[model samples]
Target chain A: MEAPATNNQIPGELGIWLFVAGDLIVFSVFFILIALGQKENADIFVQSRGKLDLWVGVLNTLLLLTASWFVAIAVERCRTGLGATASRYFSLGILCGVGFVANKSLEWGSKITQGINPATNEFFMYFFVFTGIHLLHVLVGIGVLCLLRSVSRSPGLNERRIRTLESGATFWHLVDLLWVVLFALLYLL
Target chain B: MLPFFYMGVFAWSGTFCYRVSLGTWFAWVMLLIYYVVKAIDRVEQEETASAQGQRYALTSCAGLLRNLAHAFGWENELKEKNVDPLFRKSMVFCAWSGLIAIVLFIIGGVILGEMLPPLLRANDPPEEFVRKVNEHLLSIRIGSVFLMLSFALFGPFGAGIAALTRRAEKSPVFSYVQLVFTSCGTLVAVLVAFTWALMAFRPDVYHPTTVQMFADFAYFLAVFSVPVFGGWCVVIALPILLAEEGQECFPRWVGYVNLWAVLLFAPGQLVLFFKEGPFSWHGIVALWIPFVAFFLWILIMCLSMLKAVKADDQVTGP
Candidate 1:
C-alpha cells in the first residue's frame, strides 16, 4: 500500500490523536516509574529481569510489530478504496493480535506456576502490572480490529467510515508501539 | 393593605424588643406572612385577568421578585420553552457541589485527617497505625464528618452530569448507565470516609490490629475500587464521543478528558497487588494520581456544565 498522496491532513479523527497523546504520556509515566524502581533496587531488578523468558518476549514483540504492519496497510487500503483487500489485511492483524495474547498468557502462566507473582518482588510487581495493562490494550485492539474488518466489508465507504477505520488502526498501532517499549523495558533493558 | 399593617406592627415590636430572640422570630413570621399574602394576591389577579381575557401587570413586589428570578435564571415558566429554569439551577447547584467536595476533601482528608503526608503507610506496623490514629483522634472524627458530607455531595454532582447526558441522547440508555455508575462511585467514596471515621472512632478501645484493619479498609476502598470510578468515566465519555456533531451536551474534548481519567484511574487497580512502592495504596501512582485526577475531572465537568447552562439560557432567551 502506497502512502496516500501526501496531504496536510492528519490520519484519523483529531479526538483519537488526543487520546493517543494522553495514553502516551501515561505510559511515559509508567516508564519513568520503572526507571526509578530500577535505580532504587538495581540488584533485585536485574535478578528478576534475568529470570524472565527472553524468547517469549521477543516473539510477542515480533507478533505485535507484524500486527501493526498489517493494520497500517489495511488503513492505507481503506483510504485508497480497496475495501475488500483492507478486510483481508485486518483479519491478518487480528490473527497476530490473538497470537500475542496467547503467547503472553503462556508466559505469565508459566511464571505463576513457578511461584512467581507480582507480590514476589518490586521488579515483578511493576513487570506484571505494566505488562498486564498493556495486554489489556492488545485485547481491546483486537476487538477494534474486528470492528474495522466489518467496516471494511461494508459497501460504499463514506468519509466517516474511513475515519473510523483509520482511528481503529491508529489504536492498534498504539498497542503494538506500547508493547515494543514494554518488551524492551521488561525483558531487555 | 392588611399585610402593610401587620408589617408595621411586627417591625415596631421587633424594635421595641430588639435585644430578645422573640423579636427576631416575630420579625421573621411577619415577613413570611407578607410574602404569602402578596403571592396569593398575584395568583388571584392573574386568574381574573386570564378569565377576562386581558393581560395584567404584576404588583410591584411580585413583579420585582419575578425580575430577580429571571436575572438568576430561576424562573419556573422557562420550563415550557427550553430547559427548566429550576432544573438549570439544580444543575448549577450540583456542579458547584464538585468544588464544595474538593474544598471539603482538602480540609477533611488532607489537612485534618493527616492524609497528605500519609500518617499510615501500608507497611507500617499495627502499633504505628494505632498510635497515629490515637494522636489525631479528635481531628479525624471532625475531618471524617466533613469528608462524608463532601463525598455525599458527589451524588448530586453525578446526577447533574447524567441529566445533561440525558438531554444529549435520543435514548436515555447512557444516561442511566452514568447514573448507575455514579451511585456506585459515590457509595465507594462515602465508604472510604466512613471507614476512616470508624478507624478513628474506637482506636483506643480496639486492638491495634483492628485499627490497622480499618486503615487498610479505608485506603483500599479509596484507591482500589477502580472499576466503579473508571466505569463512571467510561459511560460519561462514551456518550460525548458517540453523539452526533452539534448534538453533544458537552464539548468533544470533555470526552477525551474522561478517557484520560479512566487511564489515570487504572493504576489504582494495582494498589491491590502491592503493599509498598508507587503502586501501593498510599503511594503516588495509585493514590495521588487518581485522587488529583478525579478532582480535576470534576472541576472540568463542573465548568463545562456551567458553560452549557449559560449557553442554553442565551439560546432560549431566559
Candidate 2:
C-alpha cells in the first residue's frame, strides 16, 4: 500500500522487459495454438474464415505494410541526418496504425452485429482470440508511436533515445510481419 | 516438451523445493528469452538505414518501447543513446530480483503450506493437491497471482521507469515532469477501482451474474466519488515527467507524473482508517487520487514508445 517502494527506477529495464516478454509469451501461446489448432480443426476454421470479410483483412494488411514502408523510409532518413524529414514518414506510419485500428473496429462491429458469437465454435474462438489480441498489440503499437513523437520534440531525443526509437521501429515491423503471417494462415492456408 | 513434462513433475514436487523446481530453473530459460530479444533489438538498431532490417526488428515486437514510437506516428528525434551503467545495471538487478521473488514465492508457498501446522490451512483440499499444493497455502495464495503478475510486469515496467528516470536527470526536456504527474493520478484511479471492485466480489464460484458484479462495481465507483476523478485529472494534467532524451520527444514536466502518482496514493497508506470504514471506503477513496494517475503513466509509456519509433525512423532516414 505504501507505494511498493517503487521510485521510478526500482524494477528498471529488466522489469519492463519481463512484463512485455511475459505478455508476448502469452500471445505466442495463443498464436501457436491457433496455428496448431487450425491443423486439427480444418473444416470449422475454414468455415469461420468463410464468415470473415477477407477484403478487410487484405486491405488492413496492405495498409499496414505500406505504413511500415514509410516508417522504414523515416528511419533511413534519420540515419542520414534528416531528422524532421524522417519524422514525417514516421507520422505516416502512425496514421496507418490509427487507420488499421479503425478498420479493425469496423470488422469487429460488423461481426458482432451479425451474431457471430465467440462461443460458436473453436474457429470463432481462434478468430476472436487471435485478431483480438493482435488488435490490442496494434493499439499498443499506436500508443507507443504517439509517445515517440512527443518525446522527439523534447530535448531528450539523444543517441540512446534513438536506440530506443529503433526498438519501437522493430516492434512495429514485427506487428506488421506477424499480421501478414496471420493473414496467410487464416485467409489463404 | 521435456520442460512441460518436468513442469508436471515439478508442480507436484512441493515437498522437494518448488522454487528450485520451477522458478529458479525455468527462470533462466524465461530470462534468456528476454535478454536475447533485447540483444537482437540492439543489433537491429545498427540496420535502421536498411529497409529490410528495420522491418525485421520493428515487426518482431522486440525492442525498447521507444522503437514502437517510430513504428507508430511520432517524430524520430531521439536517437540511439546509452544510460549510465549504474542505472542499467540497477535495472538488470531489478529483473533478477523479480525473478528471484517468483522463485522465493513458490518456495515460500510450499513451505508455508506443507511445513506449517494444520490449523493454518483450509479444511477443503483441491483435486490437483499434489501438483498444485500452493493452492493450499492460505497466506501466500492470497497474493501469489499478484506477485507473479507483478514480477512479470517488472521487465517492461522497469525499463519504462529507467528510461523515464534517465530522461529526468539528463535530458533538458521540461514537460515530462508534468506528464508523469498526470499518469500517476490515473493509476491511482485504476487502483481504486481494482481494489474496491475486485475485493468486493470474489469471482462468484457459480454462474456469476453480470448485474451483481456491475452493481458492486458501480457502488464502489459511487462511494469513491468524483473527487478522486478530479484528482486523477489534476495529477495527469500536470505534465510532470516531461523530460526528454533528445530534441523531439516531450517536455521536462513529464518526469514528475509517476512521482505525483506515488504522492497522491500515499494517503491510502493510512491502514487504520481503511480497515474501519464501510465498503473499505477510506481505502478506496484514498486510492482515487493515485489510481487514475498511474493509468496515465502507462498511457504515456505506450505513447512514448510509439513516438520514439517515429523519431528513430526520421533519424535513420537520410
Candidate 3:
C-alpha cells in the first residue's frame, strides 16, 4: 500500500504514523497527570525541580535534538540516493543516543546516591516515572536506529527498505520530541 | 468482655491487623458495576435486534432468541450462528475472564494481599504472621478461591487472543506459542495465589517458619516469574506488528501497547534484590504501575476482540 500523506509528505510507511500518534497520546496523558500533581504539591514540586541538575537536563536535551537532526539529515540523504553519507549521519545519531543514555544514568545514579528517589515525594515520583518511561522509549529508539544503520549499509537497499529506515528515523525523532517536553516539564518548569 | 478478649490476644501476639484496604474494595465495587452494566447492555441489544427481526420478517426471531437464551445461561439452545464459533467463544471467554475472574483476582491479590502484606515480605516474625493471617481468615480463603478461578479463566482468554492473531499468520506456529506462553503465565499466577492461600489456610496450625516459606513461594512466583508473561507479550505484539496492513487483528498501536506493557513489566524483576524500594512488591514502580498497565492491556484487548467479533459476524452473517 502507498504511504499515508504526512506533513510535507513525510517519508515512512503509513502504519508508523499510527504508532507515533498513539505514543504521543500516551505521553500527553502522562504530562497532564504530572502537571496536575505539581498543582497539588506546588511547594514540593518547586523544591524538587530545583534539586534537579539543570546542566544535565540541558546536555541531554542537546544530545537528543542533535540526534534528531542527524536522523532527519540521514533521511534526506537517503532521498537523494546518498547511502554512504546517510550511514555516517545515522552513526552520529546513534552516538548522540548513547550520550543521552550515559548522561541519564549518571544523573539518576547521583540522585539515588543522594537518597532522593520517587518515594521521597510526589514530585520525585513523577520525575522518575515520567523520565523512566521516556528513557525506555529512547533505548528502543536507539535500537531502531541501529537497525536503520544496518539497512543503510546493505548493498541491495530497495524502496521498501528505505521506507522502513525512514519509519525508524521518524520514531527516533519522536523520542527526541518527548525528551524535550520532559526536560522542560521536569526541570525548567 | 470482648474488649478484654481483644486485649488478651493483642497482649499475647501484639497488634497485628489484616483487613482489606479501602482502595481495593472500592476497585472491586467499580469492576462489578462495569460488568453489570455491560451485561445489561448486551441483553438490551439482543432484545432490540430480536424485535427488529420480527418486524422485518427477513429472518426467524428464533436465532435472536437463542442469543438471549445463551446470555441467560442456557448454552444448549445457543446454536452457533454463521459467525466463526471460535471468535464468538473467545469473546465470551474474554468477557468472563475480565469481568468475573479479574474481580476475583482484585479481591485475592490486591485486597487480601494488602491486608496481609507482611506475609509476602521476607522479614516478619512467625507468630506475628500467624496472628495476622488468622485475623482475616475468611476473606483470604474466599479471595484465594476467586484468584484460582481467575487463573483458570486466563487459559481461554489467551487462546482467544491466539485465535485472533492466527488470522494474520501464514503458519500457526506463533499462535500456538502464544497459547502455550499464556497458559504458562496463568499457571504461574495461580501458583502465586495458591501459596498465599496455603499460608492463610492454617496459619496457627503450621509453624511460623513454614508460613513464611509459603509467603516466599507466593512472592517469588508473583515477582520473579513475570518474564514468562513478558514472553507472551512479545508473542502477542510481534504478530500484530508484523501482520499484513489491513489484515491485522487489531490496530498496530495495540501491538505497540503490548510492547510498552512488556517494558512496564520489566521492573518486577527488580523485586529480587530491592525489597523495600519502588521495585519491591508493595512499591509503585514494580507492583502498582505494572498492574495498571496490565489492566489497560486487557481493556484494549477486549475492544480488539469485540472488533474482531463484529468483523467476523459481518463476514458470516446469519
* The best candidate in terms of TM-score: 1
Q: List the candidates' TM-scores in order.
A: 0.79, 0.46, 0.66
Q: What is the DockQ of each candidate?
A: 0.16, 0.04, 0.12
Rank order (by DockQ, best first): 1, 3, 2
Q: How accurate locally is residue B315 in candidate 3, as Cα lDDT from 0 to 100?
A: 59
Candidate 3 C-alpha lDDT tens digits along B1-318: 475455445544542433434334445445454464355345534544544543454334656776788889876433333346765766767755755555666666666654223344444566766776788788778878777886777777787788778766767878999988987988998887788789888888899988877876776676577679788988998888677534677665567667767766776775665556455665655665566666556655665677667766775663
Residues B119-234, candidate 1, lDDT per residue (tens digit)?
Answer: 78998989999888888899889989989999999999999999999987767999999999989989999998999999998887999999989988988888788889989999
Error of 2 at A165 (Å): 4.5
Considering TM-score, which of the candidate structures 1 and 2 is the better prediction for this target? 1
lDDT of 1 by residue, A163-189 (tens): 789888988888888888878888898
Query: What TM-score does candidate 2 get on C-alpha atoms?
Result: 0.46
Candidate 2 residue lDDT tens string, A1-189? 576554422111222333344345444655666777788888898878888988998999998999889877766666566666666787889999999999989988998899986557777755765676578669878876776665454453445456556656666776797788778876777
lDDT measured at residue B22 in model 3 versus the true structure, 0 to 100: 39
Interface RMSD for candidate number 3?
Answer: 11.2
> Which model is ahead, 1 or 3, in terms of DockQ?
1
